[model samples]
Target: MAEILFPALFVLLALGVPVAFAMAISVFVALSFGSSYPSLVVVKEMFTGLDSFPLLAVPFFILAAEIMTGGAVTLAILRLAQSLVGHLKGGLGHANVLSSAMFAGISGSALADAAGPGSMMIKMMEKGGYDRPYAGALTMASAVVGPIIPPSITMIIYAMQDQHVSVGSLFMAGVLPGLLITGLVMAANARVSHLRGYVSGEAMPPLAEILRIAVYAVPALLLILLIVGGIRFGIFTPTEASVIAVFYALVVGMFVYRSLRIRDLPAIILRAALVAGAVLLILGAARAFAWVLIIEGLPQFLAQTIISWDLSPIVFLLAVNLLLLVFGLFMDPLPGVMILVPILAPISLALGIDPNHFAILVIVNLTFGLCTPPVGSLIFVVASTANLRPSALIREMPPFFLALAAALLLITFVPVLSTWLPGVSGF
Candidate 1:
């Protein structure tokens, strides 16, 4: 089945089928032609994949992001970020990076960040005399931080796959590395802005005005603390925290922000449902796909082959990083996580790598793929939102790509960056 499974999957992908359908169809093909197993096993495995209680968090978190966007919480975050960094060199660029970090706490998805606030930042940067492609590129690069920060949808899915780390620990573990990625992207922006002679047109707001903006944004900002702090202190489970996130987004959007209306909710709910449905379908397909791999003993075979190499933990990590980087270029992070974690994680455990550290490394590596070509979802989102060509954005990506690779290497080498916060928070 492995023979038919992989080739059929690649052929479907090359023909431009969506990843979910590609995986599902490949599973059907593999079963029908390559094995005696009934094709009904595909449906069974997909349903089994979606059966977990923790999987309930996926839709709630997604809906919370949609509500926050509808309610104008995203605008408040943009204002807060602009005030803080809009006066710096390459001011709008800096604000773009900062706002992504802030929004990551709320959205938890890179495509969400890129499509919502990231689009807005690109327009603002163009108005401020920055090149359009550069703005789009920066937006795409910075938006990868979405899943690296706490309350991440990726982390939620990841925790379900690997038992050694809980959702809360992954949430806490993501903070420093997310910020590290943000900082590197910002530094890249600063260098590019200097070379291009981009300067700030907006002066720093008065202290009183900045204070007012911060206070206005407080309710939205507190959602992050509420979710993370609540989970860390055992006040709520991550699943419960997701539910609270939706309610909190609702209250903040409709009443506090006054941007969301009662009449607006149905559309918001429908949109969130569509997005969540897509995500869940991918997970279901990935499950059936992984079931094929497991049944064929692909994971055990690869694990044993890698283990027999007698690699050190550090060497094993470098090798995994290279494999994931190439893998990411062809796959989105979510499905990548579902398929690869099951194979790579046990190998890392046997190598004595810390689970939290290995988890973050896989995540950060795959998230980078969202900005790469051929299958880079964030690249398309940013390109479509900003009316820029993907080639233009890709051409402008070298500096930011180097910046992200540097950060990945740092996370790969410095285990503490991914583990420290979780450790201190008692995870």
Candidate 2:
């Protein structure tokens, strides 16, 4: 049954069926003939899968991201980042990375960053005489930070699936690694800029000028703080924080920035609903699949299989990283986390690895998948926005991939990098 389920799903995905549909079909097939499980039980399990309060956090966080994107916040971050970095060689590329790091706080979804920032930055870079494919490739590369920073939708999904892992802790765990990636991007941009003879703006902006823009950007920054701080301080859970985030962004966009209008609300809600619905369906289906795997002792089977090789923790982590990277190549972040986390949770725990650390590692692994070949959503988004081929982006992306791989290795061995801040908060 297990063999049939995964292979059929992959075959369907290979044929270019939508991932959610592929998962649903696979689940149905698994229930029908793979095991002795009743079809009715599968249906019941699917419903129960979504019966989680924390799961509500997914849509609200996604909505907050949408609202923030539609508001002045996106422009303000871009402006501030440009002021700071737009004077250096390949300055615009560096600006893209900085803007993504800043916007990661505001809009937690990488897809949002890729579409919004990638569109604006790619055009600006082209106008500045940077190669279109280069601009597009850079945008796709930096957008990876979106899910690795605070307020991430992926972190919310991780929390919903694993009760023992706190959303707040996962959020904290992402901060340092996210910053490291940003730095790596900036370094790469410097090299590319120097080699390509990229030039900064005619005049460097004054520090006071940069500070003024940052001041105006206070509202968006506050929204991120409100959500993350509220969660860590126990003022609210992830779900409550998400609700607050929506209203906060709405008020800021309307009253403070005046960028959001009444008409925009309907569109925002509709778009958010579409994204939320897709995510929830995937979550529900993955949950059902997870239940079946556990019932059939899949985790134990996997653990025993790994033990048969008599590997070390380093070997095990490396193998898991490779596995996740492959899974990420074919699917989006949420589905990969939903289906695989449960299966590996027991194994990771038995190896004395922190589950929170493991969750961060898994997400980071999956994050790279979004930039890989075939179905990498970020790759596709950046390519389309820049009118470049995925193959083109692939070439420009390998250096950043090296940086990301190095960061992954650091986080894998240095669990304290992921755990210290969360532990300090007593989460």
Candidate 3:
């Protein structure tokens, strides 16, 4: 049964368990020899894989990023990304990668951009002297641009597991790989904020305080350019562009940034419905352990063991970028892209590739496993909001995880950097 169901759910997730109860004990140990199915078809495929209607765009983009980070549009996009990169040369490490690419467009949640602008850019890079574990390792490497931008709740659980792929063409193929990993982590955070001196100098604010922080961050960057230009011009369908980004963040948080009051809307809609009911109960127990690994064929025994190793779609996408960077340093990118993107999307479409460029190279190698150590959820949310010591923010995130594993090996063998804007939006 697919070798005793994914090695007993990777040995109960290496004994720590709890990846949604190790995907319901690997879908009841791969339906323990189904004699004509029905052990109630594993409780009706774990509640019909979260009974999706475009997975209600993952709790209205997690309650419109908890009502636009509960106030004045995340400190007016951190004072317009500190008046356009604070004053350069490591100006709070280029204002912590330009306020994490404008709070990864209104908090798509890399643990809320590593505990909200990585705990205020690691206490303003330790009151400007820096080195609090390299400002908690560049705010956990610009909190992996909160799941690579575009109002992403991991692209709404990868467009509710392929409804012919179009959460606005996977948010326009994550906008130039989230602006090329935010310009390669703000030019490696302005060269380690000018090699450790960690520059501070502030001034540049006035142009009427950068036009009143660009008119209160142009109504939250025009609700992320009208939900990625109304889902790239077709007008709307990332669940109707997440119900027009939760009624444009509730008409700009209750009448233009009044800071959303009605008793803070029922604890921000019950903390975004308890994190979208624990990510739709781990996307309905990893879709009944990916329908028992596609009824046990295991993607044609992994495409005949990679066509008996006659490799060369550039060495099979460089060994599938070292097996998705060792399954993103031990799983979490939406149940490892809902259990290895339909077994590596038919082995990268039988090596021709381009299933939306192998689903943006398996979500930029699962954001390089969130920043690897013992499972790096954005370096354990910037080492528990900068109190520090997830191995001292993994020695300040190994050179921003080696510039995000060299832009995930050049966007995994450059399928034109994720199929050139999903082929100019005509998907």
Candidate 4:
């Protein structure tokens, strides 16, 4: 059963089925044909998987992002980022990266970041005399930061998989690494600017103009600090924080920015529903697939095999990174988390690896996959939204990939990068 199950799953995936449906089909076939257990367990487990409260955050966070992105927020963020960095060498590139990071704080979904501010940045950078492919690559790269930051839908799903990890700790664990990725992006932008001989952005705006932009952008940016601070202070669970995010986005969009029309709510909810429903469906399907693996003793067998190797924690972590990088290359992070976390997380704990640290490493690995070639969803998103071929973006991905690799290494070897904030916050 073990041998036949996984190979069949991959074969189906390689045949171009959607990940969720592929997983369901593979498991259903394996169980009905090979296992002694009744196949009906698959439906039971899939329903059980969707029966999670923390999972509720997925839609709210997505809705909050849609609402904020529905109006003036993206423009304000672009203006603020441009005002602050647009005069630097590669300043437009810098603004593009910076704007995505800000949008990440609101959205926590790479696709949203890519489709929203990322598309805008690509056009903005192109208008500033930057190459189209370069702009697209940077947009996809920066959007990867979305799931690595606080209020992440990915982290929330990961928590549901591993009960030892609370959502708040995972939320706090992401802060430092997210900031590190931000810095790496800017550094990469500066290097590309010099090497490619891109022209500088517009002249540095006056300080008053900068101040005005920042002041106007304050309400939009405040959502980040509010979500983080509220979670850290124990004022709300990650689920509740998501609700606050929605209310805040609504108020700012309708009242402050005045860019969101009252009539727009239905469309916004529908969009969020489509995205959220897809995620939840994948999650349910993956859960059933995971149930098959557990009943087959695949996770335990693998865990014992690794333990018998007596690999040091450092070596083990490096191995895990390599493996996850490969997993990430072909898969979306949602199914990636649902499938891999259940199998690998307990092994890390057995090795005395910090679970929070391991979680961050896995999260970061899957996030970077969003920018990878072939199966990377965000790569396609950036290309279509920016009106370029996928090949164009692939040719420009190396520098950004290296920058992200560097940040991932820093987070992996430095456990404190993920643990410190969680510790201080009493988690």
Q: Best TM-score goes to which candidate?
A: 1
Clashing pairs in 3: none
**lDDT (0-100) at residue 350 of candidate 4?**
89
Instruction: Give the winner by lDDT: 2 or 4.
Output: 4
The best candidate by lDDT is 1
Name the candidate, 1 or 4, with the larger TM-score value.
1
Per-residue lDDT of candidate 1, residues 292-406 (tens digit): 9999999999999999999999999999999999999888888899999999999999999999999999999999999998889988898899998999999999999999999
User: Whole-model Cα lDDT per candidate?
Assistant: 0.94, 0.83, 0.78, 0.88
User: What is the C-alpha lDDT profile of model 3 across 47-128, one tens digit per residue?
Assistant: 9988868787888888888888864887778778888778777877777777887888877777787787678878977888
What's the residue-level lDDT of 301 in candidate 1?
97
* CA deviation > 4 Å runs, candidate 4: none
Candidate 4 local lDDT, 235-279, one digit each (tens): 998889999999999999989999998899999999999998898
Give the Cα-based TM-score of candidate 3 against the true structure. 0.37
* Candidate 3, superposed: residue stretches over 4 Å from native: 1-7, 11-25, 33-47, 59-79, 88-94, 105-136, 139-141, 144-195, 200-203, 207-209, 222-241, 246-329, 333-369, 374-393, 397-427
What C-alpha lDDT, on a 0 to 100 scale, does residue 172 get in candidate 4? 88
Candidate 2 colliding pairs = 1-34
